[model samples]
Target: MRVFLGITGASGAPYAARLLAALVDAGCEVGVSASAAGYEVLATELYGDASLPHDEVRDRLVGGLDGVTVYAGNDYSAPYASGSAKVDGYVVCPCSMATLGTLASGAMDNLVHRAASVALKEGRKLVLMPRETPLSAIHLEGMLRLRQAGAVILFLAPGFYHEPKTIDDLVDFVVARALDQLGLDQTLVRRWGQ
Candidate 1:
């Protein structure tokens, strides 16, 4: 399956990174985009360098993962911009509120929003993993609107039923749930019965 993974400025950079790695390991064709703030957050949270070069930044963020294509946020001509591109699904692993609002309002100011809009218009699976806390009414409304528009709003609320013991486990829980939404089987998290 083809997947579009969008990373935003949210604090959960590890989730996006893990999700991309999992998708690649699962043998899916993945297209990735990191928002401007996403780069800053990633630099601060993942990499120690706060002023890394763009290519070096991407390399550090992606860590030599295969089967994934990275796109610029401003590049509207990317394959994901066209409905005929035939992407099976799209996931904003750490979707920011700004991006969510843009998607809800039908604003294609960037490639991330545009790809999501394309997914919605084409009736493809568009999963949003919003990583906000103490959500305001506006955020809830934006999520509601996206849901009504047929986009799956997957909040970054990881379940503790599996008793996660580490940060990686927590990240896996959410990524596993995302993979489930995409209809791909995974054991990233322990199931209730298992």
Candidate 2:
């Protein structure tokens, strides 16, 4: 599978990082992009350093991954920016309201928004993992619009029925669910009936 992963300026950096690794582990061709704030969050959450350079933060996030391509947020010429690029799915992990609103408005301000727009227009799978709490009406409405447009609004809330024993387990639960939505089989978390 060819998937585009966008990390936005949200709180769930762990989820985004885990999802990227899982996607590569599943043998999928992954394309990743992170916004400025997304890089900062990754640096702080994953490396315990918010002062790291943006390139260094991105390098840490994608350094040892194979079959993964990293794109700049403003790279509109990326293959994922076009429906003809044969992208099977697009996911915005830790999707922020700012990014969501841009997508909802049908504006292609960056590669993330452009890729998502292409996914939606092409009838491909587009999953958004938003991590906000206490969503305002505007946020809900944007999500509703995206849902109505055939995008999957998978919030970053993980189910605890699996008796998660660690923070990584909790993150895996959500990543597993996102992979499921992409029609990718993964054993990151135990199945409900298994």
Candidate 3:
């Protein structure tokens, strides 16, 4: 699978990081782009240093990972920006409500939004994993609009029915579903009714 993973400004940096690793482990060709705030989130949540340089953060996030390419937030010329590119799927992990509104309103300000727009227009799989609480009416409506547009709004909430005992387990629960949505096999979590 060829996948585009967009990291946005949200609270679930762990989810985004783990999902990126899982994508590469699944043998998918991955393209990554992080918004300015996304980089901060990664640095703060994952590294405990919000002031870490972008290059260092990038190195930490995708260092030594093969089959992955990192693009700038403003890199509109990326292959994922166009539907003509053979992208199998697109994911906006830790998708901020701002990004949700932009995508729902058919607005594209960066490569992330453009890639998602192309996914929607081309009828390809697009998964948006947002992490937020107490959503207002605007957020709900935007999510509804995107759902109706055929995008999967997979929240970063994990179920405990599988008896999760650690934070990584909880994170894997969500990432496992995301991998499934992208039509990739994942053994991170045991399947229900197994």
The C-alpha lDDT values of all candidates are 0.88, 0.91, 0.95
TM-score list, all predictions: 0.96, 0.97, 0.99
Error of 2 at 18 (Å): 0.6
Candidate 1 weakest lDDT stretch, 10 residues: 48-57
**True lDDT of residue 98, candidate 2:** 91
TM-score of 3: 0.99
- As a whole number from 0 to 100, the lDDT of residue 96 in candidate 1 is 93
Give the CA lDDT, 0 to 100, for residue 187 in model 2: 95
Q: For candidate 3, which ten residues in a row score worst on lDDT? A: 76-85
* lDDT tens digits by residue: candidate 3, 45-151: 99999999999999999998999999999998899988888999999999999899999999999889999999999999999998789999999999999999999
lDDT of 2 by residue, 20-123 (tens): 99999999999998888888888888899988998888788888999998999888888988887888899999899999999999997778888899999998
Q: List the residue pairs that clash in candidate 2.
A: none
Q: Tell me the lDDT of candidate 1.
A: 0.88
Q: After superposition, how far is residue 144 of candidate 2 from its true place, in Å?
A: 0.5
How big is the positional error of residue 48 in model 1, measured in Å on the Cα after superposition? Answer: 2.8
Residue 79 accuracy (lDDT) in model 3: 97
